[model samples]
Target: MPAPFRIYNTLSRTIEDFAPVKDGHVGIYVCGMTVYDHIHVGHARAMVVFDAFVRYLRHREWDVTFVRNFTDVDDKIIKRANEVGKDPVALAGEFIGHFHDDVGALGLANPDHEPKVSETIDGIQAMIGNLVNSGHAYEQDGTVWYSVESFPEYGKLSGQKVEELRSPDEVPGKRAPADFALWKAVKPGEPAWDSPWGPGRPGWHIECSAMSLGDIGETLDIHGGGLDLVFPHHENEIAQSEAANGKKYVNYWMHNGLLTMTSGQKMGKSLGNVINVRDALSQFPAESLRLYYLQSHYRSPLPWGPEALPEALAMLGRLYEARENAEAMGGSEPVEQVISGLGEDAKKVFELGQGFTSRMYGALDSDFSTAQALGYLFELARAVNRLANHKKAKKRGGPVVAPALAAFASVAETLGLMAMSSADFMAEVKEKRLAAMGVSHDAVEQLLTDRRQARADKDWGRADEIRNQLDEMNIVVMDRADGSDWKVRLVAAN
Candidate 1:
C-alpha cells in the first residue's frame, strides 16, 4: 500500500489528507510554461516544486500520472513572434525547446503528458461546445465567453465575488466584466483553428481546463501552479471545468509561492526583474539551484538575491563533505558496539540517522514541508561531522556511521540532493565556478604547481606569496599528507 500524506489545498485553505480518486493512484495536472520565452527562476520554482513533489510521491510508492500543459497558442506567443518576424507556432516551438533544455539542465523529470494547446484544439473546442450547450457559455461575434453568473461558485477558489470584479479588458463582445473568453475570435496574422464560433483559438484559461480533462479526467487528484495564478487563471479554470463537466474540477489545489525580489515585488518578466534559469544554471551547478528552491517551504515566498546560489552551494557543500567523511570510515563491528565505544557523538549520529526517514517523511508528508525536512538533514549532517572528528571514527567508525550513510543515501533518493558522488559534485562545482570567475583550470593548476615546488624547496616566502595569489582568485588550497589539491571557494571572498 502507498503511504498516506497531507498537503495544503489552496481551495480549502487548509492542509488536508490526500485521498486519491482511484486506489493508490494520483492524477495531477500542473499548469506549465507559456512557451513565449525561456523560463525564469520564478517559473522554475513551480517546476521544481511540482517535480520534487512528484518525485517524493513516486518514492513513496504512489502511482502518479503527472500532466503539465504548454500554452503554445497564447497571445504572448503571437506578439513575441510578430516582434521577432517569426511564425507564432514556430516561436512557441523554439521556446518549448529552450524550456526543455533549461529544465533538463536543472535535472527535472519530464511530465507523463506534456499536452500542448495547439495539439489539444479538439478537446478545447469540445469543452467550449459543452459549456455553450449547457448555457455556461455564450457566443457573440465569433467569440465564446464563459458565463460566470451560471456558476454561482465562480469565486469559490479565489474568493472574489463576481459583482466586485472588474473586467480584465474592455473587449467588445464580452457581456459581463467577470466573464472570460473561452474561444477567442481569430485575429488577422494570428494562428487560428476552425471552430463552430468560426476560425478562432482557445483562450488562456480554457486550454488548461480542456487539456487537463483530456489528459487526466473531469476531476484531478491535484492541480498545481504558482500562487499568483490563484485569482484569474485557476479561478477561471475551476469555473469553466465545473460548469462544463458538472464535476469538481480539482480535489486539491496546490500552489507554490513566488520568488520575490528584495524590494518586495515578485520576480516576473513583466516586472522586468526576472532572472532566466539558463543564466543561473550557467554559473552554478544544477543541484545548487534545486537546493536553493528546496531550502524554503513550498508555500513561502523565496527571496531572490545575489548570494542565494552561492549560499545554497555552500550549504550543499557541507552536506556533501559530511557524507564524504562518513563514507570514508571503515569497520566490520556491529553498529551498537562501535557506538558504545565511540561515545556520545557516535550515539547521536546513530540515533539521528536511524530516525531520519520518519522525521523527514513527517515533515514532507505534512504539507510537503521541505524546509523542515532540509533542517533535519542539516542536523544529521552536523552530527555525522562531529562523529567523523573522533579519533577512532576513520578506522573503526564505519559501523557506527553506517546508518548515517544510509540517511545520506535516502536524502539523495528522496530529495534529489547529494545524488552525485563527492568527486563528481566537486568537479562540477569547480568547472562551473571557475568558468563563472573566468579563471582557467590551467592557470589554477600552474599556480598550485608553483606553490608545491616552493614548499618542496623549503621556501616559505614564495609558497605564501603564491598561496595569497590563489586566495585572491577565490581558490583554496588543501595540503594533505599525500600532496596538494585545491578548489574554487564555494562562497565569495570577503
Candidate 2:
C-alpha cells in the first residue's frame, strides 16, 4: 500500500494532505538555473533539497515525474553574453554543461524532464496566443503584456497586492504598473523566433508556465523555486498559466529558502558575493556540501560562514565513525538475548534501530523535515556508539547492531548520505583537505619518518615537538597499535 503524506503548500499557506492528481504518482516542476554563469552554493541548495525530496518519495514507493526547466533565453544571459563578447545561446550552452558537472559532483539525480526555454518557444507562443485571444493579454508596440486585472487570483500564490508593487523603469506600452511582459519583441543581435505577434522571445515567467504545462499538462502537483521567485517570477507564472488554461496552475507551491551570507544579505550574482559551486567543491567533499545544505529546513534561510564546511565535515565524520564502529561488531546471538545481557544501552540501541525507519518516514512525510530526520539519525548514532563501548561488543555484538546497520543503509538509499564506503570517504577527505591545506604526501611522510625515529629512540621531547608542529599545520597524527596514521584535520583553523 502507498503511504500517505502531507506537505506544506505555499499556495494555501497550510500543511495539507498530499492527494496527487493521479493515484500513486507525483508531478513536480522546479524552476532551474538561468545558466548565465556557474551555479553557486545558493542555487545548489534548492537543487539538492528537491533532489532529496524526490529520492525520498521514490524510496517510499511513490512514482515521481520530476521536471525542472532551464531559462536558456533570459535578459541576464543576453547581458552577460554582450559583456563577454559571446553568442547568448552559446554562452547558455556552456554554462549548462558546467551546471551538469557541479550537480553530478553533488550526486543529484537528473530530473525526468529538463525543459529549456529556447526549445519550448512554440509552446510559449501558443500559450501567449491563448492569453491574448482570451482577453487576458494585449500587444503594445511589439511586446505582449499580461493584464494583472484579468486574473482574479493573481495574488493567491504570493499574497502581494498588484497595487502595492513599485515598478522599475516602465516602457510606454505596458498598461499597468504590475503587468509583466509575456513576449519580448526581438532586438538587434538577439535570439528570436517568428511568432504571430512578431519575431520575439518568450518572457522569463512565461517560459516556465509554458514548458511546465507542455510537459506535465495543465496542473502540476508541485511547483518549486527559491523564495526570491515567489514574488514577481512565480506570481507572474500563476497569472499567465491560469489566464491561458482557465484551470488551477499548480496544486502546491514549494519555495526553498535563500542562502544568506554572514552579513545577513542573500547571495546573488548581482551582489558580487556568490561563491561558485566549483570553487567550494574544489576544497571539500561533495557530501560535505550536501550535508551543509540539508542541515536546516528547506524553507529556512540558512546562514553561510567561513566555518560552515569545516563544521559539516566534522558532523559527517561522526556519522562515518558510528557506521564504522557498527560494522566492526561481531555476534550471532538473538537480539533479545544480547540486549538482556548488555542491559540499558544495548536495549536502547535495539529499540532505536527497530523504530528508525518509521521515525525517518514520519519526519520526511511531514513537510520534508530533513532537520528533524537528521536529529533522529544523530540519536541512532549515539545509541550505536554507546553499544560499541561494551567490552563484549567486538566479538559478540554484531547481531545486536544488525538493525542499526540496516538503518544506516536505509539513510543511504533514501537521503543519499553515508552511501560511500568508509575507505572511499576517508580517501576523498584526504585528497580534498590536502589540496586545500597545500600539504603533500611526500612532505607529510618525511615528517612522520622523523617522528617515528624520535619515538623509537625514546626522544619523547623531540616526538612531542614534531607532533605540535604538524598540529599547527592542521594535520593530525594517530599512533595506532601497529603503525602511525596521519590525516588532514577537518576542524577550522583557530
Candidate 3:
C-alpha cells in the first residue's frame, strides 16, 4: 500500500485524507502552459509544487501517473503569431521547445504524459458531441455553447452562480450570457478542425475537460492548477466533464497560490512584472530556484522581489556548510561517548538527526506542509553547526553526526534539494553568480594572488587594501589553515 497522506482539496475547501482511484496508485492531471511564450516564475510555482508532490509520493513508494497538458491552440498564440509573422502552430511549437529547455535546466522531471490540445482535437470534439446529444450544450452558427444552466451544480467548484456570472467571451448567438463556448467558429485566418458543427476549434475550457477525461478516465485522483484558474476555467471543467461522463470530475482539486509582487499584486505577463524561468536560471543555480519555491507553503502566496533568489542562495549555502562540517569529523568512537565528552551540542545534534525523518514525514503527510518540513531541516542544520563549533568535533565527532549526514541525504532524495555535492554546489554558485554580477573570474583570482604575496611580504596595508577591493566586487575571501579561498558573496555588499 502507498503511504497515507492528506492534501488540501480546493473542491471541498478542506484538507482531506488522500485515497486514490486504484490501490497504491494515483492519477493526476495538472493544467499546463498555453505555449504562446516562455514560462514565467509565476507559472513555475505550479510546476515545482506538483513536481515535489509527485516526488514525495514516489519516495513513499506510491505508483504515480502524472499528466500535464499543453494548450497549443489559443487566441493568444494566434495573436502572437500574427505580430511575429509566423504560423500560430509554428510559434507554439517553438515555445514548447523553449519550455522543455527551461524546465530541464530547473531539474524538473518530465510528466508521464504530456497531452496537447492540438493533438487531442478528436477527444475534445467527442466530449462536446456527447454534451450536445445530452441537452447540456447547443450549437448555433457553427459554434457550440455549453448551457451553464443545464448543470445545476455548476457553481459548486468556484462558488459561482450562473445568474451572477457574465461570460468573459462575448460571442454572438449565445443562449445566455453565462453560457461559455465549447467550440468556436473558425475565423478566416485562424486554425480550424472539422467537427460535427463545422470547421472550428475547441474552446479554452473544453480542451482540458476532454484531454483529462481521455488520459485519466472519467474522474481524476487530483486536478491541479494555479489559484487564479479557479474561476471560469476550472469551474467550466467541472461542468463539462461531470455533465458528459455522469461521474465525479475530480476527487480532489489542488491549487497552488500565485507568486505576488511586493506591491501586493500577482505577478503576470500582462502586468509586465513577469520574470522568465530561463532568465532566472541564468543567474542562480537551479537548486536555488527550487529552494525559493519550496521555502513557502504551496498554498500560501510567495513574495517575489530582487532579494528572493539571493536570500534563497544564502539559505542553501548554510545547509551545505552544515553538511560539510558534519562530514569532516573523523573519529570512530561510539556516539554516546562522543556525546558525553562534547556535552549538550553533540547530544542535541544526535537527537535531532535521529528524529528528523519522522518529524519531516509528519509535516509532509499532513497537507503537504513543505514549510514545516523545511523548518525541521533548518533546526537540524543549526544543531550540526553548533556541534561543529566544539574544538574536539573535527577529530572525534564522526559517529556523533553520522545520523545527521543520513538526514541530509534523506532530504535530497525526498525534496530534490541538496542533491549536489557541497563542492559542486559551491562551484556552480561562483560560476553563475559571478557571471550575473559581471565580475571576471581571472581578475578575482589575480587579486587573491596579489593579496597572498602582500601577506607573505608582511605588507599588511596592501593586503587589507586588496581585501577591501574584492569586497567591493561582492567577493568574500576565506583565510584557512590549509589555504586561502574566495566565493561570490551571497548577499549584496552595502
- The most accurate candidate by TM-score is 1
Per-candidate Cα RMSD to the true structure, in Å, reads: 1.0, 1.3, 1.2
Question: What lDDT would each prediction earn against the true structure?
Answer: 0.92, 0.91, 0.92
lDDT of 3 by residue, 1-494 (tens): 67899999998899999999989989999999999999998898899889999989898899998999999999999999999999998999999999999889888889999999889999999999999999999999999999989999988988987777655776679988888899999998899999999998999999999998888899899999999999989999999999999999899999999999988999998899999998998899988888999999999999999999999999999999999999998898888899899999999999999999999999999999988999999999999999899999999989989999998998898888888999999999999999999999999999999999998898999999999999999999998987789998997844
Q: What residue pairs are clashing in model 2?
A: none
Give the runs in model 2 whose Cα sits over 4 Å from its true position: none
**Model 1 lDDT tens row, 1-494:** 99999999989899999999999999999999899988999999899999999999998999999999888998988999999999999899999999999999998899999999999999999999999999999999999999988888888888888778765688788888888899999999899999998999999999999999998999999999999999999999999889888899999999999999988898999889999999999899999999999999999999999989999999999999999999999989888788789999989988998899999999999999989999999999999999888888999888877888898888877778998999999999999999999999999999999999999999999999999999999999999989998998988865
TM-score of 2: 0.98
**How displaced is residue 348 in candidate 2, in Å?**
1.4
Q: Could you tell me the TM-score of candidate 1?
A: 0.98
The TM-score ranking, best first, is 1, 3, 2
TM-scores of all models? 0.98, 0.98, 0.98
Model 3 C-alpha RMSD vs. true structure (Å) is 1.2
